[model samples]
Target: MLNLVLFGPPGAGKGTQSEKLINKYNLVHLSTGDLLRSQIAAGTELGLQAKSLMDKGILVPDEVVIGMIDTKLNENPSAAGFIFDGFPRTVRQAEALDTLLGQHNTGITVMVALVVDQEELTKRLLLRGQTSGRADDQNEELIRRRVQEYNEKTTPVASYYEQQGKYVAIDGIGEIDQIFGLICQKVEAAQSLES
Candidate 1:
């Protein structure tokens, strides 16, 4: 198993890279955002709760999100591995994730963080907004807020993985393929070490 956490600020290209990684590695993609959307679509209690928070531009509670992850994990008993995106935003959530994986006798293999500057992220997100038509992306205020939120709440999670010798930072500039190649190298290196 080669469980991975794709870590980065908003517009850092986690989605794009995760798509390629999953295709190449046969890993299940567990994106918390997609999970929340599905729950809301199904009108589950947790989804309703998450919707209320998300509507206010706030994050859903960790336990609610974690429970969703639990469900996903249980649903895929035979997955080669999983690529986790946008779930563990704080140290507490990171701890919870480790415990959850521990219950399954596996743990995060690596946390591949895509490093991008604030200005570049803002530019990229706004450009994406033109095509994405996501209301949050259209507002520069919201974009900056999202980045700041990640800086304050999420960056420490990288350090948590770093302490465990499972953190790798990749520059998030230049061509998409180039960046993804770097990510692939990091993941393969980690896999080799584990083997």
Candidate 2:
């Protein structure tokens, strides 16, 4: 299976690229943010829990998020593979993911980190906020906090994958297709190495 993780700061176009990759490669795109939103919209137990934490500008506990992912994986056991987006945001979650996948005899094949400048990210996010009506994106303070949280808590996960020789960094600037092409090249190379 070609299990992969798409890593990037918010507004780095990870969602856009993940959707395209899923369509082209038949990979299941599992976005933690989307999953949480779905649960919230559905008024599920997990959703209620996460909603409260998110409203407070605090991260949902790792255990809650991991449980949600576990459910998704169980429900998609026959899927070809998965593209994890906006997940493993903490080293604890990354470690938990390793254990969860290990139980299924599967491991992450590669982790692709989309590199973008902070200024560019901020501009993209503000634009997205205006278009998407997402409250988090609309506030510069919140956006900055999100980026800071990503840098402090989530960026280490990339190094974790790097230590395992499964990390690939790609430029996240330019046209969407151009960035995606760079991602595909790295993914293909990783597949080749695995084979």
Candidate 3:
């Protein structure tokens, strides 16, 4: 399995790059945000609980997020691999994910961290807001908060993976395809070593 964790701040183009990588490599794109949105739209019980917290601008409980991920993994047992985006936002979650995957005799093969300047991230997010109509992206304060949260919470998860020799940082300031090229190169290198 070629499981990967695509890590980056909001507007760092992690989502865009993950899409391209998935298309080119035949990896399942498992975006936590998209999954949560689906759950919310479906009005599942987990969605209802998460919705209340999200509506108030609070983080969803880790357990709730993990439960959703567990469900998805169970449903996609036959998938070749997965590109996990917007997940394992903390070291605790990272450890939990390791345990979950280990139970299946699989583990994360690589962690790709997309590095972009804060200014560029803000600019991209503002433009994305115009097209995406996402309230969080449209509001500058919220976007800043989200970026700060990612730094405080998610960055350490990258370091954790780095200690395990599974982290690869990619420059995220360029055309979409350019950024993806860097990522693909790193992924191919990592997979070759494993093979």
Candidate that would win on TM-score: 2
- The worst-scoring run of ten residues by lDDT in candidate 1 lies at 50-59
Over 1-195, each residue of candidate 1 has an lDDT whose tens digit, in order, gives 999999998899989999999999999999998899888889988889888877666888899888889988999999999999987899999999999999988999999999999999999999999998877788898889888988999878988999999999999888999999999999999999888
Assess every candidate by TM-score.
Answer: 0.95, 0.96, 0.94
What is the TM-score (0 to 1) of candidate 3? 0.94
lDDT of 3: 0.86
Clashing residue pairs in candidate 3 are none
Instruction: Estimate the Cα RMSD of every predicted model relative to the unseen true structure.
Output: 1.3, 1.1, 1.3
Prediction 1 TM-score vs. true:
0.95
Candidate 2 lDDT tens digits, 1-195:
888999999999999999988987899888989988998999998889888877666788888778878888899998888999988888788899999899877878899999888888989999999999888888888888888888898778988998999998998998998888989998888888888
The alpha-carbon lDDT assigned to residue 179 of candidate 3 equals 83
The Cα local distance difference test for each model comes to: 0.91, 0.88, 0.86
Residue-level lDDT tens digits of model 3 in 45-74: 878887777665567877877777788888
Model 2: ten consecutive residues of lowest lDDT: 53-62
Evaluate model 2: give its lDDT. Answer: 0.88
